[model samples]
Each structure stands twice: as C-alpha cells, then as structure tokens.
Target: MNLLLVVAAVLAYTVSAQQCSTPRVRSEWSQLTQEQKGLYVRAIAALAAKPASNQYANPDIMGWHDFVITHAREAYWAHGNAQFYPYHRAMMWQFEQAMIATGIWPSNMGVPYFDWPAMSQNWWTSDLFTEQYLGNMNSNDPDHCVLTGPFAKGKYQVAFDVDNRRAITSGDTTCLRRNAVQAAGDDATAIANSMNAGSFAQFTSSTSGSYYDTTNYHSTGHFIFGGEGGDMSNASVSPNDPIFWLHHGYVDKYWWRWQNQCEQFLYDYSGTLMSANDPNGNGIDAKASADQYTASWPFKVQQLLNTQGGDPLCYTYSKSAGDIPLAPLTCPPVVKPSVAPTTAPPATATGGAAATSASRQGSQLDDKWLYTALNLLVKQKPLGSWGNAPKTGATAAGGIQAADAGDVVVFGRRDLNETESFNGTLEVASATVQADETITGTIAATIQATATVMATTSAAVSEPIKKEQNAYIETINPDNSTTISYTLSNNTIEIPAGFTVYSVMPISATAINETSGKPKRFFPEIPKLEYVQHAEAPVNVEVGSHPCHLAYPILLPESYIESMGMNYNKYFNAHVRSKMQIDAFNADNCTTMFSPSSMMNFNSL
Candidate 1:
C-alpha cells in the first residue's frame, strides 16, 4: 500500500512534463526584448488588417474584432457568473493561438501581462502608455483617439462606438480611443484581498462583484482605461483594446496563485452559471464542476484550472512584477502510518466576531491562545463589531478553555490604556487536541503590518487630502504555520473632492495549515461587505460639451438595473448626478476627474 501510494504521487506530479514537455513561459510586458515586442506588435497589426468572417463580425471589421464581438455577445453569460475565471482563461489560450496563426509571431510568444500593483498609483506614467508600447493613455482629440504608438489613428481603425455596441461600415473609420484614469484595485492591498480569499465563491465576489464592484481589479482595470470613449472600459467590446489581453493575463496569474494555495484548489469550482440575482440566470446550479464547459468555449472548466496542466493551456507565467514563482507540480509525499499514533480532531469552522489578545511582553502573544480565543469569540459575537467586556464568571459558548485546562479563560475587548493586573500564577494554555495535531500551549508570536496605498493626492492646506487605506494581517505562528487574517473593518471612508480613493477591507480570515507538509485551509464563512464613501463639492454641468445621451437599455439591461435596486430610466438622473465625474463631464473645469464616464456607467451592462 505504501509503495502504491508513492507511485501515485510521482505519476500525478509528472503528468505536466509528460503532457506539455516544454511549456512556454509568459513574461511581463517590460521583460520582452525590443525584437519580441516588435514581433508581437506586427502580429496584432496583421490580425487587425484581415477582414473577419465570423457570424458576429461586422462589415469590413478586421479579424481582431472577431474576439471583441464574441466577448460582447457572451458578456452576459461570461461575467459576474461562475465562468468568469475559467472563461477568461480559455479566451487567453484562444488569443494566443490566433496570434500564432497570424504567422507574424512565434508559438513561444505568449501574451505578456501588465502588473497592476507594480504600476498601481502611477499607471499614467507607465511604459505601457508610451509611443514604444500600446499608445498614449489619453488623446488631445475630442473623440479621445490614440494618435501615436503602433495602433495610432489611421493605422488601426476602431470598429466599435462609445457604448461598444455599434460597428462602423466600410467607408467610415474610427480611431482607437482612450480616456485613462487611475484604476481601483491596482494597489497591493487589493491583490492581497484577492490572494487571501478562502473559496471560489469568496474569490469571485471580491474580485468581480457584478459590474458595480469597483474594488475588484476586473471592473476597474477596464473602466480606468476605457473611461467613456475608450473601448477597454465597455464589457462587451473591451477586447477591441489591445491592452485587454495584458490585463486579463494578470487576472489569470492571480487565479493561478490562489489555486496554488492547496492541491484541492486546482479542482475547486463553484458558483452559479450566472449571478443568482440575474433574472437571465434562472437559478442554475450554485456549485460548478470541473466537467463543466466554459461559456461560448469548447474547453471544460477543468481544462482551464491549471495553466500548464490544463488541456491546450501549456504556458507558464515567468516571475514578473505582479507574480510569484510557480508552485511545484508534484503531489505531496506519501507518509506511512505509525504502528501507534495519536490523531487530532479535524478543524471545524464557524463565523462571527473574533477577539484579539496582547501579551504583557508587548505585542508578542501566544499563538495557540490567540487562535483559540479568537475562534471562541467569533462563535459568540457579531463580526466587525467591538466585543463588550466579559463578566467575571462568564464563559464563551463552547466553554472557555480546552479540556486540559482547570482555570477558565476570560477574554473580551479590554481597554488598551487600562493598567495591567494579573496575578503571577501561570495559567496553563490548552487547545481541543494534542499539541502536535492541534494548536495548544502558550507559544510566542510576533505581529507585523505593511501598508500599500493606491493614490496619494496632497492639496493646498485649505483642501482635504484624498486617502485610501487597505490592510490585512499575516501572523507567523511559533510552529512556523501562518494565518493570514483579513479585517474589513466596519468604518466609513471619506473621500474629498478632486481625488479618487479605492479601499477594500477583509471582513474574515483564511488560514493555511502547512505543518503536515501538505496545504490545509480553515475557511469560515465570510460575508461580502461593500463600503463606498464618496464626498465631493457639487459642480454645475454644461451638458452640451459632451452629448447628453442616456445609457442604452441594452447597456443597462432591466435585469441588471433591478439587481442594483435601480430603475432603468431614472437611474442616471437620480444616482449618477452626484456620482458622475464632475470635472470630466464639464471638460472645462474637469482637471480633477480622470475621464468622462463614471465607474457606474462603465459597469452598466
């Protein structure tokens, strides 16, 4: 039995090498040599030059636009649904094939990714928006056309209109446009929130919560670059922008990172065909399966799970700006059972408020004690709320301490400034199971915090400075086990006028148990928390500067509007006035605002 298990482990790990043999590595955009970039640019140009023949293709539209059209057609089904990750992964593979088919680039020329976190707050100055790369972020033209770069105006005619619904005829030509802005979720904080998600459901919700989830990199990545006139912002025709591939490449990398957390995650799949609230979804299965096919694609969700192992996905991500080294593709080593062994009860999860304990030796505390007390407090109190002082004789719902401890453990929110008054008697620390199996005993701990911000705008003394803050705690246990606790503190953020602030707070915890030499996760149910606070001084709008057109019904479909608790016709007038970019819309005094379209507008449908 032991030999058989060892053989199975070796077989599973070697499958990738046997199947792919030589996996192509996708590099960061800047990592590409000048010759590589030139080849890629030429390949894209070739795709854009050929006439499309697909059923969805428009008159005189290039082969490249075929992808944009397909993306638009499947937008409703592919996004805010269970297929978001898998579907995009398939699309990436397909585009790579198309690029190779163009005969301008080599098969090894995998699409490069833009690391949002690396260029987070300073995206405008990125090389991606330069003459040598994609193009200048914004255009002087009123239509916001790209006047430089390889895909400059008159070089590559854009096929779609502002809403990305209408395509031009043979005689008419439109230049690719850009209305750039600082995107949300481009910072490290947002990336941490995504990487720390415990389950696929939690991952999807935090990464792409419908169209309205600005905190997610998906929506913001498109919107900030796509701003009203830009093709990248519109969900349907976003692929029209060459930058779309790079953006999704990073997204794919993040999902890959999440899956590497455990062996189970590679097969982990769940969530409905579409958002449950979407009327079109009609309540399909909430749990997705590996056998399931991605929307509008022939590949199964299972095939897209692993970049190297997934069928037709034979590329690996090279160590780049916003990525980590790939985890080994080997199965865990098999361990033979001992003749006489002690077992620890399996860890169970429950949710609510968690408590924190500080040792008299400053920030150093006991790992087992902290985990037990926090888990205990969570079961009794509500999350994100302060725990009141516990009574002297009171005990938590599951009983105060583990079976071994004689003295009761009393804990709650104690005043930090209060004087310490503990008798010198040493109280024994205990957990539910043996010290080796389960956490037990009072062990030393060290807590460290690192902060990553989005944009920091310092104004004159009279004006308020715009600030966004996101924080998550990573605790290194005495046993070297790590617990990554995400705290979405229940506090309202205030954004001053003329600044954009994006913040995400983790309302729960996701911890990994690696002592056994295999990854095990403790995931408690963490509810989705949306906190959006925007404060701005109202400005008078000169409506005619930009056309006063309403968001098309197709763009803001009835089902989507209903999900957001908004009326189709009245939504713009009622909600957008206060939220729209006052500076961008006004054009004349719109220096503060990044672009003409509001974040909500970009997400409409």
Candidate 2:
C-alpha cells in the first residue's frame, strides 16, 4: 500500500469533536479572542524577515526547525493546544498570502491546504529537517511509523496506528499532557543545540556546492525553515508543489519562537546570506556578519508568542477557525544597544607601535637613496595606474611613484618652514677638464643641484604636487677626460642614471590653516631626460681621422630617477593570458617576447 494511503487510513480511524481550523483573514475572526490572534500574526511576520543566510539557514537552525515541527506535531496530538495549531495555521495562511502578494504563486493557483500527516512525511525526507525525527522514526519505509514494531514491514501497519492517534484522543489524561510537555521539551533541546552550533562558517570558503549557489524555491524553502540544503534551482522541481510553504512556515515559526525564547538571539539578528544579484534586491553585507541587531522593531517573536488576548501582544484564535482580535495589540519596544563596549584597549596596540617605530627609523636613511628604493618597489608592485602619461619638464606632481627595486622618487624643494624643523639636502656639482689640462675644480663646484623649500595652507592635499623641498638629484659623466654635468635649480632635482621621472602633486596641505602665516604652496616644473647616442668630433692630428668616443651625462629629475628601482615586468606578464594558457606553456613553445625568459633578460638589462 502507498505510504500516503496508509496514513490516510490511519487518520480516518481517529475522529475528533473539533474540526481542523481554517485560517483567519483579520485578527478579530480567530476563535482564541482577539489578542492571542494578534500575537500569532506578529510572530509570523517576524519569522518572514529572519536573516535568511547566517544563523537561520545553518544546520543548527535546521535542527531547530525539526525540533519545532516535532513539538508542534506532538502538541497537536497530546493536548490539542488548539492555540498553537492556529498560530501555525495562521502562519501558513499569511505565507500563502505573501506568496500571492509577491506573485510567487500562480494567479489560478488556489490556496494551498495543510495536511499535517503529509507534511510529517515530507519533513522525514528533507535533508535539512530530518535528523532528530529520523533518529526516533523509521523513514526508509513510509508505511511504518515505528522503528521496531511487528508491523513495520507492511503498509497500514499497527505501528502507524498507535503513533498517529494515541496522543490526540487517548482517554489517559497523563499521556495527553505529557505530549504537550514533551513537545516543549523538544523545542528547548533544539534551541540549545542550535545556540551551541552558532554561525555557519561554510560561506567563508570557496566551496562550490554551498547554499549560496541558487535562488530556487527549494533554496528559499530551506532558508525559511533554517535547514541545510543546496541551491533550489535543481531541474526536478514541479509547478504546483505544496511543500514549499509548509516547510517555510515551520522555518519562520522557529525564528519567531527563538526570538521570544532567547534575548541574545533577538539582539544577534543579522543578514549575511548571498543571493542572486538583483539591483533592487536587499544587498547582503559580508562584513555585516560582525554587526548585531539593535534597533527597536514594532514586534519581536518572543513577546508575540507569550502575550495573551488581553495584553497588547494578544489576539484570539481557534484550530477550527482563524484569528479574532479582542483588543488592539501594540508592537514591542526596540532593544537599544547590541554590542558591548571595551573597558580597556586591545593588546595588539603595543605590538603595532613597536613595528611602526622600527619602520620609521629605517626610513630615515639618506632620503634620496630611500626614495629611489621605494620608487623601484612601487613600480614592481603597481596596484593600479595613475592615469595619463606625464609630460616631460612638467611641474612636480606630489604623489610618490615607486620603482620595482623598492626605491621611491620624490620631487620638490628641500627646505622646512620655521614651524617645521627639518632641513635635509643632497648637493651635487661637476666640472670638465681637457686631456692636457689640470683638474682644478673644488667639490663645491660639483654641487649643481639645489631644492628650495615652500610651505602652503590648502584644503586639497591629494592634488599630487606640493612646493616642499623634499628631493634632489644630479648627474656627471667623463668623456675622454671632458666632464659633462647635469644640474637642478631651487624647485627641481636632476634625474640620475637609468631612471624615468614622474611627478605627483598633493591635493592640498593640512598644516597650513587659515591662521597660519604661510602662503599657498605650488609645485615647480620638472625636467625629464632620455639617453641618446652622443658622438665626439674626430681629431685630425692623430693617425688619419680617428673618431673620439663621447659619453654624455643623462640628467633625469628626482621623480624620474626613482622609477628605475623596481622590476614590474613579472606583474605585467601575469595578467596577459588566462590561467589555462599560462599553464599550457613549456620551455619550447613559450619562447615569446614577453615570456618569463625574455622578461628576466629585460630586467637584467
């Protein structure tokens, strides 16, 4: 016999004076007076808005769902708390209404009916809500409700007969009350179990089969029920399935109940679930995992569950009919603060201070050399581009440009204002001597590079260039004993050998305020150089006319010289092809202009 047929047969055997209730449209129509009905409605609404991903969709949350379902079933059977039945019934009705309101259900689709026995079977098959129930029941064969009964092997067996009807209409008063108490006990156990298994950590990794992968009804169903399941977009779903809402309402009910039972639970409400990208959909803040609920909402799950018909949280309801309101129920007061403030500073501060001090002291070595090194590092480790190519001999831009060699290029003057006490300088100059002439130039004559200091009071500090004396550079070359010199004036630094210079200006300076006496600072124009072959004239006296070789000094501004330090060739190569294409290359086929071997040769040069 079919499992459904067997369960139906058993259901027919038990008859009650009270009929299964219909859902109420408004709060006043419920059998339980008006107030209890209001509480039920509020609880349902709270469950609808549960944090679908984090604590709710967790396996622990699923366990709670099962526990709640089991208890609700148990309560219905044992004491016929009729009150609890209406809450769930009303919840289902509201959920269906929402589905209709949101157009999730077809227009022609009549309202779904809730057959508790069928629902019980559905829960038994679900991966998210079956663990606890499975432990006590025989799920392999739906015909048998008993795990170890004589009739377990056949359909319409006696095992199903006992469990389906014993608690509901049994004359034994002790058994009837025990059922309700046991149901509550199961609920408590599930909550404790769920609390112990906090936050789902699976979403943090790169695993492909997580619950975040789909947006189908199954996934949505799991989300509402707080169960563990894959994305719902599986191809096997049908159009007229009734299990979706039954499962979702149960899930929602758990959240509602959890809100009431645990103060910590209400404060911890958060949304960290991933959903399909929809522009108008609620955005999931991954960092919100750390945030806790603090705002006072109009209703909370806890107060809704506990309030009676006369209280502000109350509403009336009956299992045979929907909700009725006796008095108007007001929303619950919002909880203010969720997180606790620190009484003392964290221990990491001391460690961080030591690290910072060490770094600053290390940076104080010759600023030019340090700048050059940082420029190289920056070039090799470019995070993003700085826009259009810089023009030659332009004003010094104030942003630092790093090189692949960990060198930094700084451009500008090198003097400090009276308010600031730093005055650092690097001076260089050169003089040429003919082959037969005596070398008669002092070291001071070689000091041809100079940087002037300027101070500014401005609001925009990131404009890229500021008039501060922060860098200097000079170059000198000897060609057949003739010296060629490259120099810089007050606002610029000559670029050294094998360097490319770029300038950045600061947006504005913060040290210069309205009350400060300093004028607004501006960067001076910078000169850039490119090395070209320079040939010396032929000397007629020696042999026929031997060509004299000449070596010209290349003068680059401070910023351009710093660009030579870093090696960014590797980073440039990495982004050229897909990962598969890169993996496909071998020593033979991979010999291209930008290949690893060629890049190494370029770096060496």
Candidate 3:
C-alpha cells in the first residue's frame, strides 16, 4: 500500500474502538470549568503516586505502545470509566483541566461532544486532526498552533520550531510517522525482550548500557516517543506518546533530587534557547546555559542511574532493590617533603697566623652546621645574613635542619646604634694586580693633625708677619688653545669648548715666582709646551690597487643614468608584448595565450 493509505489504515485501526465518539478538540478542552482542572490535578497526582506493582506486574508488558496501553489501563482502573476517557478524550479533558488551572477559558470547552458520524457530516469533520496537523505545519507558527494552551504554554513553547524537520509543526508527515513507528518499535522490543530476559537486573543492565553516551535528539527522541515504536502517524502524537509525560515526570523528579544533592546546581536555569515565547513571538532563552532539565517524577536520575527496579519511575517487573546507594569515586592524596634533619660533618682547619686563635681539635659543635649545609646545598643559600644554623643540639644525623636562604624565614631585627663613630684608611696591599683585589684581613688606621709652627722674628714684629700670598701663572696647551678663555673658581672649572676636555694641570709655584720676578716673566726651567694631546685622531686610508683605466676620472665608464634608459626600454618592451598577447586573447584572434584554448588542446591531446 502507499504511505498515506498505510498511515490511514493504522489510524483507523487505533481509533476503531472509540469510532462512535467525537474526537476531542484542544479548543473544546480549553473551555472546561475550574472544577474539572482540580479533578484532573488530583487524578494525575494519585496516578503518579500509584505503586509500580499495581501497574506493570503482568506478563504482557511488551513494546512501548503496549507499555503505554498498559499504563492507560492502570490510569483507567485507578480513576474508573466515568472519570476517564478514550485516548483523544482523556487528552481533551486534561487540556480543560490545565486551562481551568491556568485561568484561561477558551469558548469551545463547554460544547458537548457530538457523535463521530454526526461531526463528520458537520462543517468540522472528523478529519480535524489531519487538517489541524497540516494547517499548523503551513502556518509557520508552531508554538501558537501546536503548543496553544496552558499545559504546553509559557517557557515550554520556546524551543518549538515550525521550520524544524522533526518539529510537530513541520508538515513532513511521512518523517514524523516514521519516527513515531521506530520509537514505538524500540519500546515494544525492549519491553517484550525484557520479559523473557529473566529479572529486571538483566533487562535494566542491558538497556541502560551506553545510554548516556550521546546527547543527540535521536537518542533522547526515542525515549520521548515511547519505549518502543510509537505511532507518530496519529494526530495525537503529543498527548498519545505516553512515554513523553513519564519521561518529563522523571525529569521533574531529578530536579527535586538535584536540589538536595548538588548544592551548586541550585540557581535560576538559563540557556541560549527558550522553551517558550511571549505574545510578540520572541525567544525567551534560559537564564543559565548550563541549566539541566530533570525529570519530575518521584524518583531521581541518580537513583535511576544504577537502578533497574523498585523506583516509582520503574515498572514493578524490575527485580532489583532500588534503595541501595551507589559508591562514590574519590581521588588520591598528594605527598610533600617533611622538615627534619639527621647528620654531622668532619672538622675543618682554623684560620692562619694573626687570626683569632681557634681550636681545630675535636670540638663539639651542633649538627646545625650539617643541616645548614644540606639546606644550602638544596636551596642554594644560607637562611639569613646572621647565618642561622640548626637549633643548638640538633645532630646532622637527627634530621633536624636549618632552613636555606631561599627557605622562607619569620624573624625581626632592630638597629641598636645608628651613629657610633669610627675612622680608618683604606690601603692597597699590592700593585699591578691583574684581577680585582679581595681584601680578607682586618685593619685599623690612626689619623693625627697639628697646626704648622710659625717663626716669630724680632724684626719690628711687622704687623703679625702675615704669610706672603702665592700665585701661579699657567700657559694654555696647543690642543687646549681652543679653550684658552676658560675660568676656574674655587674647585669649579668651566670650559666653553665644544669638544670634551680630559684633564688640566696647575702651574708649579717656583715657575710662577720666576716668571713674576723677571721683567718679561720668563721661566727657563719650565717646559715650553703647547696644548696637551689627549688622544690621536683616526686616519682613513684606502687599501688594494684599482685598475689604472678605472682610476682616471676623465676615462670613467658611463654612469648609472645611462643604464637607466636600457632598463626602461627592456621593461616597456615586455609590457607591450604582454598587452599585445592579452589583447589578442580578448579579441579571440589567437587562442594560444587563453586558458580555455589551452585546456581544450590539453584535453584533445
């Protein structure tokens, strides 16, 4: 049979029992009174609270569709025939319940149910399901058409996409039906196989295996449809897919569990995608992208992760006890070195002569030195300037050790005297030292100062005989002649010369006195020097011999300017040739330079 006919046949078979009753319409469901919603809430709660043993203990739990049938049967049994309805009717009733609870009263809810035959003859045909499905797809507004009322309203409508191939609002009925069939098929297989496969332990262990490996829609979508192959060809895929509600219930359950378990998990949920939209049709993303969606059933995912039976979410046929807790995994501790010391070292020689006398014999020094040495060797330094050895009696072999300089220390010090006076002169022990001199010995220098004795002659004691003032005359050096007009006052010297001046010497007193005594101020003993040359200027000289012909300026070769014309001519010729080739190719006058012609030729060859 063709795909559509096959789908029609399946739908017909599925709804055959309730063929006389009018199909429940979501619009009609929205008009139910408040009393109906309360009743629904209670019924659903009671149904949720029912023990698994009361529901799936029979030998017939086979496929996902069958499981769903079994669950509906349980709900029927719990609520009685008056309180329940056929698949479509029950959904309509629930919608009413949700509407009343949400304070929305759609106009169609109060309309009485018309017989299927009568309704089919009316303006609204029994094919309302098909029409609605097709209409929702073409509307390009899945959230508005599919998730119309309270139960599926609010944030829940956000993720719905009319354009999605897998979306309910997408008009691809074939794919949807196929998906439903596959889902129902899988659930049915898992259920039927689990029955013959011994206890719940065997079934759960096998089914739960590798389930968490992927987060793809297919992996999750399978469960969403039902345990096995769900019937997607039906218009009631949303409410008819019994597994959807159960799975979501469990998601809610996990939320409650997370509240008690993962402390950090508590917060406003957020994400890039929204579960629903507002009236203006804008997305409402989650508050936190990492927020987890959990099942709302009485049992948690943690409880279900290792469990196959006994929990509220599991069927009673499951044989395992669900109360046992799983063992938690932990990491190992890290280890570090301890602070202790243990050994001693051999004695070393004392200082040489003139040094304070020190005994080198068997002196009982603490093992502090050994600890200190080990620390210094390891950390590469002493603990402080005062050089802390280990505690007094700590033996090198005892493991008690001093900290190295790099080792952190906690101590304090205060300056006792800031200005205790002491004077000493520094002297060089030896001269012409190639390397830097390292003074090792201690020294103490003494300094004494006295006024010079003045002769007090009896020659009329001439006005206290003040010392004759002395002065010197200096001549400028040849090199320094450029700076002849410089000035010297006190110790400060000034030179206006652009170049740097190295050193200057003072004239001798005897030379100055002789110069002053002579009429022309001549000093014969003094050197007749010009400017002192501090350093010699560098000489620039060319090396190697040049060809005689190349050396003569008059016979020099043509300059670079002459070569320029030749270069330009070569460049212009190349450009002209390229332009000619391009123009020929453009004109289709020649095919050699064109890629299309070349490719054609190559192919032919």
Query: Which of the numbered candidates is closest to the native, going by highest TM-score?
Result: 1
Tens digit of lDDT per residue, candidate 3, span 1-605?
A: 12332222222212211121222232122233556444433433333223322111111111222223323222211111111112222222222233232223332232122111111112122222232221111122332232322222221211111112123444333222222211111111111111222221221121110111111111223232322222221112332322243233322222222222323222212222111111011112212121111111111122222111111111111111111121232212322223233223332323231011111011122243222222222322112111113222212111112332122221111011111111111111111111332222221111010001001110123232222111212222332211211122222122221112111222101000111110001111212223222133112111112111000001111221111111222223322332232222223322322133332322221
Worst window of 10 by summed lDDT in candidate 2: 176-185
Question: What does candidate 2 score on TM?
Answer: 0.20
Q: What is the lDDT of candidate 1?
A: 0.45
Give the candidates in order of lDDT, highest first.
Answer: 1, 2, 3
What is candidate 2's lDDT per residue for 1-605, written digit by digit as tens? 13332222122212211221222222112123344433333333333323221111111111112222222222211111112222333334323333333323332222322222112112233321222211222233222122322112221111111112222232321110110000000111111222221321221111111111111111223222211111111111101012334443433333333344434433333222211011111111222232211111111122223223111122222121111111222233455334333232122212232232221111112232223222222322221111123322211222221122211111122121111111111210111111332222332232222211111111222333322233222222221111112122233222222221211111101111112111121122322222222133222122112121111111112221112111122112221221112122222222432233432322221
Better of 1 and 2 by lDDT: 1
For each candidate, what TM-score against the reference?
0.49, 0.20, 0.18
Can you write out model 1's per-residue Cα lDDT over 26-46, one digit (the tens) per residue? 888879888888788888888
| C-alpha RMSD for every candidate | 24.0, 35.1, 44.1
In every candidate, how many clashes are there?
A: 4, 96, 56
Candidate 1 deviant stretches above 4 angstroms: 1-18, 55-62, 160-172, 182-185, 206-215, 275-287, 324-605
